[model samples]
Target: MTRFSFNQATANRWPIPDLVAGCVAAGVTRVGLWREQVADFGLEKTAALVKDAGLEVTSLCRGGFFQTPTWYEENSRAIAEAHTLGAPVLVLVSGGLPPGSRDVDAARRHVGEAIGRLVPATVEAGVQLAIEPLHPMFASDRCVVSTLGQALDLAAPYPAEAVGVVVDTYHVWWDDTVWAQIGRAGRERRIACFQAADWITPLPEGVLLGRGLPGAGCVELRRFREAVDAAGYTGPVEVEVFHADLWARPGAEILADTIAAYEAHVA
Candidate 1:
């Protein structure tokens, strides 16, 4: 419970102010925020609201999507947003292959180069860029980086303090090599963020919003938690679920259920 951090995406429809108040009421001191939500609520206002409520922004999601033509300018803004929000890390979901291009290798190489370009800005802002590898299902349109090992490889060239990898259980649990990768990330001091979500069956049509809350599916949530702990990652365990059905519920109800689920399955 002490290490649990509620990721804002778990309740996508929750208003920022209400989310902050609800988290305060629930005694949740940490939170992971998304850029879209923050922008809609006004960045400076959102920042002040959270700070005034005594809440710590764990990490801003996200800064990558190197495939976009304006990636440099966009990511520059993201870094500045993270700095204003007082978040120590900025999550990067490296975008998929460019349109009509089947060369995944090229896309990946481009992602590495893109991160290299942003390394200076990240270092100057005192923020770590955390590379998040999505599930393979999203390899084409969302994120090409589908394994923790690959994310770490991309971060290898940059200083661990400036760039690192995200260990999201929902994305890496199926990889047989992930356990060793997690160890490698720890040894190299590159595990920048840890996210928890369950893998549910019969993934919905879109699939992107098909994640299950902790204890809601087949993932070994506690095992992953223990692995990261063993790897010397003494940071917040952020629960980041993305299900449409879950989003339909009231924000307070969602937060309560998430906390309950985290306690039973993740904590």
Candidate 2:
């Protein structure tokens, strides 16, 4: 459990104060936070809270959506925020197809360009802009980069320190080529952050919050972990399940279960 980190979205309703306290009580040293939630709690204050509690903000949940009009400004701010929070990586959900556009190729090309524009700012902040490829089911509306290989391709042009990719089991488990892609991520030095969440189905329409705890589904959590480890990733493994029912319970209860699942399935 030394490398175990909890992702805040696992308890979307958990207030920042309580989540910090709960992690401290459970001996969880690291956490993955989200932008909206951090903004809600006041960024500077949240930084002080975690610092005071001896908790490390492993990586920020997100900071990319190139399709938006103000993407440059927004991503710049996100990089700054990650620096303030002591998070080394700012995870990027590389956005989805533009409105009324089926031309995925165009959308992906735009994403690459947008990310390149943000690389300089990332370098200045000393934070890695971590590109996360969402499950293909979310391809139409959430993320167009649907594989580790594609993420690595986009990150290739930038220095490894400036750009990297996120390896989240829930998103990449179904792809047969993931093992090879992970090796490429290592060789290219782009494996920035590794997250874990089991894959479950009967996916709610839109499929955003359909994740399960580590051992609750069919995903090969250990295999993904080993692959990323083999790929030269030695960072915190954040458990990030986003399910309505899971979030409804008390934050402490959820953390306890998440810990158990991680030990049983992912450790």
Candidate 3:
């Protein structure tokens, strides 16, 4: 329980104040925040609220969309936000290929370059840019770095403190090579964040929101936890599910279920 952090996306409709209060009431000391929610709530206000409640902002999601023309400016703002919120890591969702461009290799190379450009600012702000590789299904439009290995490769050039990779279960569970990559991430000290979300069956048409709570799906949740622990990742385990049905529930209920699931399947 000490290591568990509830990501805001898991309860998307929860108001910031209510979320913080509920977490405090439930003895949850950590949270992962999203940029959209923070912007809506007002960054300074959110920062103060969390600080007053004595809660830690585990990581800010996110800072990358390298395919966009405003990538540099937008990511710079994200780094600032993370710093203000006292979040040590800024999760990067490297955007996909440009329109009508199918060259995945080039798109990936661009992501690395973009990160290189942002490293200085991140280091200056005391924030780590954590590259998150989405599942390959999102390759065409969301993220081209579809494997943990690829994310690590992109973070290789920069110092590990400036750039690192995210190890999300839903994104990497299908890859047989992920175990080895997880080990490598530990050895190289490149794991900046670790997220857990199960891969549910009959993926909804909007696959982006098709994730399950820790025990609600077939993923070997305990195994992933043990792997990260064995790999020397002594960080918060953030539950970041994005299911429509889950989001529709009352915030407290969703949080209770999330904690129960994490305890039963992930702890």
Candidate 4:
């Protein structure tokens, strides 16, 4: 059973109150919250309301940026926010190459170091840091961790229970080694979260990012599901879409369509 949840960024405009109301109305039991929205609504209040509505806080939206001297405070604050939201998994986008620094490996090391410092705080909060491997296309600016293999490698040094990986089909589907990595993640028990989106046409203004809807693209999701089931991961199949078009529609419409899509394609 793949439970479904929506990423708050999909409805970037709505307040947390409205977002929760919409998701509950649509029968969704979980959501991924962005740091900004959490702050706006105040974490404790938001958490209480979400609990009242019986919503599961799937994971926090993000917690990393391309390595930079100024990011430490920001990242630290994100960890605190994740705790405030009562989310177990904190999704990290291990930022891309910094200016004048073309060394991809160095950039990766920088992220590792940054995360190393935050391990204590995350542990204190009882939250697992989920390193999300963004698509390779965003490697230059968005995230350096672009493959499940690489994400697993980064988490290998830590206790697998505290540090794990998020498998988003939008980013990993194109990789030839994705299936193997999925199996590896399951075998290692590092698959903290699983997300879906479809590859769509007319590449948006930005690079071809997060375009898949379940069953809308060419990726064999059933096979991926098999690997996940084999590995014993029965968590929510979180729907994280950044579609420009989807954002413009009413939250109600988006929720309705998302539920329908999940049943028709991902279920």
The RMSD of every model to the true structure, in order and in angstroms, is 0.6, 0.9, 0.6, 1.7
lDDT of 4 at 35: 82
Stretches > 4 Å off in candidate 2? none
Better of 2 and 3 by lDDT: 3
Model 4 root mean square deviation, Cα atoms: 1.7
lDDT of 1 at 232: 91
71-134 per-residue lDDT for model 4 (tens digits): 8888778778778777889899998999888899999987887877878888888888999998
Report the alpha-carbon TM-score of model 1 versus the true structure: 0.99
What TM-score do all the candidates reach, one by one? 0.99, 0.98, 0.99, 0.94
Q: Between prediction 1 and prediction 2, which has the larger TM-score?
A: 1
lDDT (tens digit, per residue) of candidate 2 on 1-267: 899999999998999999999999999999999999999999999999999999999999788888888889998999999999999999999888888899999999999999999988899999999999988978888899999989998888889999999999999998999999999999888999999998887776647888999988889999999989888888899999989889899999999999999999999
Which lDDT tens digits does candidate 1 get at residues 1-267?
788999999999999999999999999999999999999999999999999999999999998999999999999999999999999999999999899999999999999999999999999999999999998988998899999999999999999999999999999999999999999999999999999999998898868887999988899999999999999999999999999999999999999999999999998
Q: What is candidate 1's local distance difference test score? A: 0.95
lDDT of each: 0.95, 0.92, 0.95, 0.81
Residue 132 lDDT in candidate 2: 95
Please give the distance, in angstroms, between residue 264's alpha carbon in candidate 1 and its true position after superposition. Answer: 0.6
